[model samples]
Target: MLLIAVAMTAILLLAAGVVAYVAFPHRGQRMPVVPWLGHAMGKAVNAMPTGTAPQDFYEPQETSAR
Candidate 1:
């Protein structure tokens, strides 16, 4: 009984390790948000510092007297 129990425990541990390894390929990659949304957001955000946007993107507010 003791040997059988030990063998079962070792088998379980090996199975758990194999499952962890095989499932690891899908572990950490960030899933893109809404298909091409990731690429679009990255381009727009990255362009801000490089000043690649059109001039009409910003507008001035009119001053008013109280």
Candidate 2:
């Protein structure tokens, strides 16, 4: 029936998508610039109103002397 054909097509498409997603080469944990990105984000955050203040953001435990 047409309904069965439509269901089979949907299932096939879903399986193919899953396979493609799993087989693709990705950047997870393998990026060389990850550390630099972290440092940049940290600096950006610590720098101002555009991000977050390093001191007040993590306060209560408070380190003395700026």
Candidate 3:
């Protein structure tokens, strides 16, 4: 019984880790405001600061209000 309980606990922890990795790909550095919304948010948030795409698309003044 104890063995089965430990195995189940380990399985649950592993599952949680996998889910976390999938949800936040960048070592959990960024967290989305909405659950499972990382895919949408990451496009802008995950871009490199030195990259052209983010600079071209990001609005500096609009975001400053927040």
Candidate 4:
């Protein structure tokens, strides 16, 4: 029972780490704790498809009212 608990905890921690890596934006630089893993994570995030391109409908006009 104890061994199973330990294994479960380890797995949970790993899953959390992976989620954190993917969710946060770490452009260009690697994670301080794990450089190689950070690099891999960055690549994985880039590989995923971004469904739509952003559109800018109109340019802002200068107004006297602040």
* Candidate 3 per-residue lDDT over residues 1-66, each given as its tens digit: 999999999999989756765767545555555545555545655574754566656565555564
* Model 4: residues with Cα > 4 Å off, grouped in runs: 1-11, 22-28, 53-66
In angstroms, give how far residue 18 of model 2 lies from its true place.
Answer: 0.1
| TM-score of each candidate structure, all chains considered together | 0.37, 0.38, 0.41, 0.46
lDDT of 3 at 58: 59
Q: lDDT scores for all predictions?
A: 0.57, 0.55, 0.64, 0.74
Provide the global lDDT of candidate 1 against the true structure.
0.57
lDDT of 3 at 57: 66
Residue-level error in angstroms, candidate 1, position 20 = 0.3
Q: lDDT at 30 for candidate 1? A: 32
Ranking by TM-score: 4, 3, 2, 1
**Candidate No. with top lDDT:** 4
TM-score of 4: 0.46
**Between candidates 1 and 4, which one is better according to TM-score?**
4
Tens-digit per-residue lDDT, 3-59, candidate 2: 999999999998974554334312233224345544454455467576546866655
Q: Indicate the worst ten consecutive residues by lDDT in candidate 1.
A: 24-33
Q: What's the C-alpha lDDT at position 13 in model 3?
A: 90
Q: Candidate 4: give the clashing pairs.
A: none
How well does model 4 score by local distance difference test?
A: 0.74
Overlapping backbone residue pairs in candidate 3 total: 0
